[model samples]
Target: MTELSLIRNFSIIAHIDHGKSTLADRLIQVTGGMTERELKEQVLDNMDIERERGITIKAQTVRLDYTASDGKTYELNLMDTPGHVDFAYEVSRSLAACEGALLVVDAAQGVEAQTLANVYQSIEHDHEIVPVINKIDLPAAEPEKVKAEIEEVIGLDASDAVMTSAKSGIGIEEVLEAIVQRIPPPQGDRDKPLKAMLVDSWYDPYLGVVILVRVMDGVMKKGQQIKFMQGGTVHLVDRVGCMRPKIEQLPELGPGEIGFITAQIKEVEQAKVGDTITLAKGGATEALPGYKEVQSVVFCGLFPVDAADFEKLRESIGKLRLNDASFTFEMENSAALGFGFRCGFLGLLHLEIIQERLTREYDLDLITTAPSVVYRLTMTDGSTQELHNPADMPDPVKIDTMEEPWIKATIYTPDEHLGSILKLCQDRRGIQLDLTYVGGRAQVVYELPLNEVVFDFYDRLKSISRGYASFDYEQIGLREGDLVMMNILVNNEPVDALSMVVHRSQADPRGRALCERLKDLIPRHMFKIPIQAAIGAKVIARETISAMRKDVTAKCYGGDISRKKKLLEKQKEGKKRMREYGNVSIPQEAFIAALRMGDE
Candidate 1:
């Protein structure tokens, strides 16, 4: 085994919007992993939803080169972790890939809820942490105050933490030197067989499954046979690729190096995150360290606006799932939505990413329902079934017992919004556990059912709190609840997007809003759309979406009969595209926007 001193590894950890992606961009560029010409802000984050929303949804690794103050060139592996609680498991996996972490605290915002959660997680993972105050270039920057907060929270000295503006490129050099000095290098047996943990992977039009792996032992070479441990699959090595910051196709990978090895792996599940990739007969260590199996926490239904596009949506999801391990799927048939899939995700943001990618990246028009959390139901006979769409929920009488997942939710917000935040949490069936005061801000921890946060809670929290509330939650366990699964129907047909599991009392408002949103989102065609909310047999609420009444009444009047006939044909084509099976008339943006929204 090589000594650990040669490998320098660390992860950039922070809350959403805290410059995690920006700092990664700087580190990658400075380390010469990516060239100026190849530089794209947030290059490590590839998902469109992630870049557009200014957050890192998955953890990414890029190897970089740096020169110490004494002129020694050292290899620095920078692990960029997701900045939200929904992705805490991901951050933990990233932590396993490194020996140290750069805990980024926003200078202007001080320590937010997510930042604290990640720092604690890093500590729990036993990775040495180096605190850094970012956004120092902002006019309201208070580096010293944040430094003190970090010291107080992490129980470490604050002097070593550097203040830097990743955007202005200030103090970046110093930060680089600090990483080399504070973080230790990777140590592994070079003589053993090759074994590495798959961290993140992406698909390029040219190179498929551009995988990022942290080598655990031995060496990887071109044209070698490999097997994935978790899924028990094998791949014939195509070519070994190295990314010394900017990606380069290489002939081999040694211990301590972070790179990719592709072997024409067509199926994404075969090569998955946290899976150990080793030689078929023998490879380094014969086993890998620190691979965590990832699971889905949130679920949603994906339906194409045009039923004919059902097959198209399914194909897009399959391709999307190739590189995105967090997205999963099972075919779902809805009396309302027709044939679709009940897709699983890591979190709400995860669900949105898949939906957006399908509509925006794949150029497929779709209608997604309100996001929902899965419920574990134990039948009276002890049989178990996990519920995703509310429609599939067994009848309450048959269920005998149902345990909805609960999360220990921590909401951080300014003092002014504390009362509203508390009230909102309480109304969502949240049980207040504790509240802490930090400067003029507050952090409130509560235990709430996952069903609450999966739907309108996210939107309501942001709205009532004026976007000041930051949220983080990890599953605590499940709790017994008098729950009702609210299923929505259009013209008496169930639409998966409108399904939800709501408390008995809140069902009315949730169903009303869901139906209204559907009425606005589902397009109008030759027939009007009727949206209804029903709890089993009886309908509690209903709304209507009318067909297009006056679209293009003009063209036929000024043209010849044949031309007028052509116009009618074009109009019919337009209707076919806009029409859904239900009683709603909507446009494309409305469909995408509806998917982007959650009715609180």
Candidate 2:
């Protein structure tokens, strides 16, 4: 491409199901970047979970070549970022790769909580944002009203906004034109040391790891040695390439360009998502800036459903960790769970996707415990440790004091539902920091402990607001907070299956929720299964599962000699997954679901 027709790189960001990926598909199709049959509803959502859930999980990169209204052919590197808060770090990294972003807002829903969050993030990252009101094909869409919403809230001109129906390809060409007109071309010094941020990467068994990077500073040749900024690790490049919308490889990649690199980099850690890579010269120990290894925010305990499947689960995680080291795992030998790993995640979606992938992708039957955030635990020795799991921590008496992680949670909703949202937050121990009105909607920011509502905050918000609210949280600081180690006892023995360390104020609600879910999930075995939540010896709540009414009444079918033996064999097979506790082999989901439904 010539100087006049270089390129403009940008990302498309919006709330869940506001048509960001659909718009992406339409954009690629209009640009002839993707063929007709190759187009899917959410083309950018390439993962099975993403397609099944109808949400973008990982950030997807696509290159588009379009002739602008000005009659100039320009290369546009489009990034589709995950709409959920769990992958916020990935979203931030995606924003880093682009010079601008398409702030997609639902025409009728107006600006949602996530939309406002992205708008703020775009400004913070210094990206030139081109606001677009998508989903204008729907009869419920109010283009003029949303145009005003974008103007009043985002402080952008209404006339500048593109009213687009990405599903029907309506006015999407204008959005592309807006990208050419508003977003700036890629800026870099090609002669300088090659530098770029590894925005996204994936592992391929046949081709090793394919790296997706946007050259931010210097030229990236087909073969060059590079170093990561965070770890100072160096690797020799084998091939530098780019992907068109069809996933085809390109010849070369340079500064002011976004493309892929293959160094036979098998591990995803080598090509981490956020790390900046630069030329390895003079054995320099450092690299480019804006690189930070993400800190895991949510944690849970996991083991295989069958004790024999433990090794299978481990191997599955090992393979997954190659692509996502962010999912940290450490083995924990619990008397109740047998052997398991204390795993960490970004948030609930991250946790769920990992579990789902393990079961569906890796074909492993697994059991997971309740999710917990890091708790600042101060020991008697005047040292601090992040208490991720309550079971692993020493006694409370050994601690002088502890601070719990807190967050400044923001929830944007329609003006009519602010009262209900506030009431719901207040019940979850939220102290209102401030509330503002934007585009006839309310943006309510509150100071809340991360443990206070991490599990059920989003669910309750949707329930209270009738699915009109969206929530996002950023770690504010650690605060002097009182939290309890709420442990669950199964069969009079403390089982990690129901342990959740929650804010002290949240004990009642969390316990009640756990108990209620447990009642629905636990099978009625030969003995009554006791479900009790306690702080030490005190049982704050309790529920009893009535004993199972004889599951083997048909053990001997007509006493047909060998046929009866086969019938009994099948019966044993059916009950193979039940957890044996004093002659009751309970179903695995009862315990697993209890942990997942913690504090919800």
Candidate 3:
């Protein structure tokens, strides 16, 4: 059994692209957890998409063995977490498994918006934070300046912060030494009942569902019966193993240890993140705190290009969900796009990742409609209703009031772009709350409607600030707004999936923009197609795509002008007849092409 004093459980937290993954690689190498022959860049980021994008989409846990200068061997479990705001929940779960964290900051860039946000989150979790300045070998490296910035912005003492260059492998030994000396060891009671928390999980073809958990109060071993407290399922533990950079079957995992458990679970739902794992026969009386069910904040319709691929898409989603439990989907049918699934995601990045995964992993083409936020509707009869898709909304006469979700946005940027950033925020109807300066950087806070920022706010902010600004936001309670439901009509027929809720003030301009975009994308057919945007029964914008004309007069070569006129007359008559009876076929790309008409 490993002694508790020699076991250190910690996580590395930092903003995106700040050398977190590279530092992780160096630590894993120098510690001999994995041989140099087995070493690779971003080894913990196992996903191909993650490696290609240079971002950590999922949390990875690894065990490392290091011997300090004090002549003592220590076992370290490092939880590598995603830094993007969309994966904040994943970061929180990773932090829950560790007692300490390495706060990595870029030497040149200093502290960013996400850096402070995650630092405060660590403070909330009461994790011991050891500030580290990375990328010191860069041309712009300013370790001393960053150390002072860390003190000013995060209010943490950084005089003893480790300065290292992950690229050159400098100070790698000092970082490991700091982990052994500064970061406290994990503490728990081995005599207590089994009280392990499921930090993360994945599905394996041979072993079924595999779960990575941190044992808090008891021992876990193979052939033991375990109970998932929140999932309310019980099963016998078929295997218990620890990840020594690879899956190694262990005899038993005791307190303060991080490892995996396979309990013959066929379905992923049985092992949920944030759920407690205890003995089935005599489990602990109370479960761990801070257990929250993941909720989808943004929703959009995902239709296959070919209607026959609906079942294939559905099966693909099921397999994806076996690993990722954050996204949700349901059966949906669109008048223009045919049958599909209405999917829900944590945020825009999550939505994009899922869409890309569906295309790449399942080999199916997809068309996604404009994303929308959930709204709360009040009926005239005092009944409350939850609305995800605008098409499901009731008539205006039967509605009393509608409430849309809101968010608290925080932005950090250089003082030079303050004017443009503030203007952009105000244009989005963001209410300025406070503004302050810290370490030569400006931090601004605003309360904005979630609908406004869900689509174009990030892109616009980056454009206005020249990529110097960083953003982070959290969902606040819903607020009442002057919102209206805007519907799109193609060929005089309303598209249910294309309906969206927008503010009444900008509805006309946005609707006009959508109509114009659709006109350019929709192909001309035998009959002219009129695309219109309307609110309730009133039309707001309209555009008509002219029909494709054929050279019927070309066949009348070497004839008199009268003969050409007669041929034209005959072609017009045929077109008129076709217009009366023929239907316009709008391709799937037309609906998707209009989704980029900005946030409405």
N/CA/C clash count, model 1: 20
lDDT of 2 by residue, 1-600 (tens): 235236888998788878888888888889998788877677777688888888987788888888887787888889888878777778888888888999898887887777777778778888988888888879898988888877887787778788888878899879988999999887776566667888888887877887888886667766678777775677778776666765666555766788788776768876777887777783334455566777898888888878998888889889998777678988888776788889999887788899999989888877777677888888889888888887876787887877877888889888889998899888877899999887777889998877756666777788878877888888888897777788877666776656777677778777877877877876677556777888878888888887554455465546558876666576665544443536544467777667657334
Ordering by TM-score: 3, 2, 1
Tell me the whole-model lDDT of each prediction, alpha carbons only: 0.77, 0.78, 0.89
Q: Model 2's lDDT to the true fold? A: 0.78
User: Relative to the unseen true structure, what is the C-alpha lDDT of residue 350 in candidate 3, on a scale of 0 to 100?
Assistant: 93
Each prediction's TM-score versus the true structure: 0.84, 0.87, 0.94
Query: How accurate locally is residue 273 in candidate 2, as Cα lDDT from 0 to 100?
Result: 74
Taking all chains together, the TM-score of candidate 1 against the true structure is: 0.84
Error of 2 at 97 (Å): 1.7
Pick the TM-score winner.
3
By summed lDDT, which 10 consecutive residues of candidate 2 come out lowest?
577-586
Candidate 3, residues 1-600, lDDT tens digits: the string is 799999999999898889999999999989888888899999999888898988899888888889899898999999998988888877887888888999999999999888887888888988889999999999998999999999998899999999999889999999999999998998899999999999988888888989999999999998888898998898999898888789898899999999998988887776778999999988897999878888899999998998899999999999998888788999998787889988899999899899999999899999988888999988899999989988888898998899999999999999999999999889888999999997778999999998988868888898878899999998889998888999988877887867899999879888999899888888889767889999998999999989888888777669579998988898889988987777777666777777766644
Greater lDDT among 1 and 3 belongs to: 3
Ranking by lDDT: 3, 2, 1
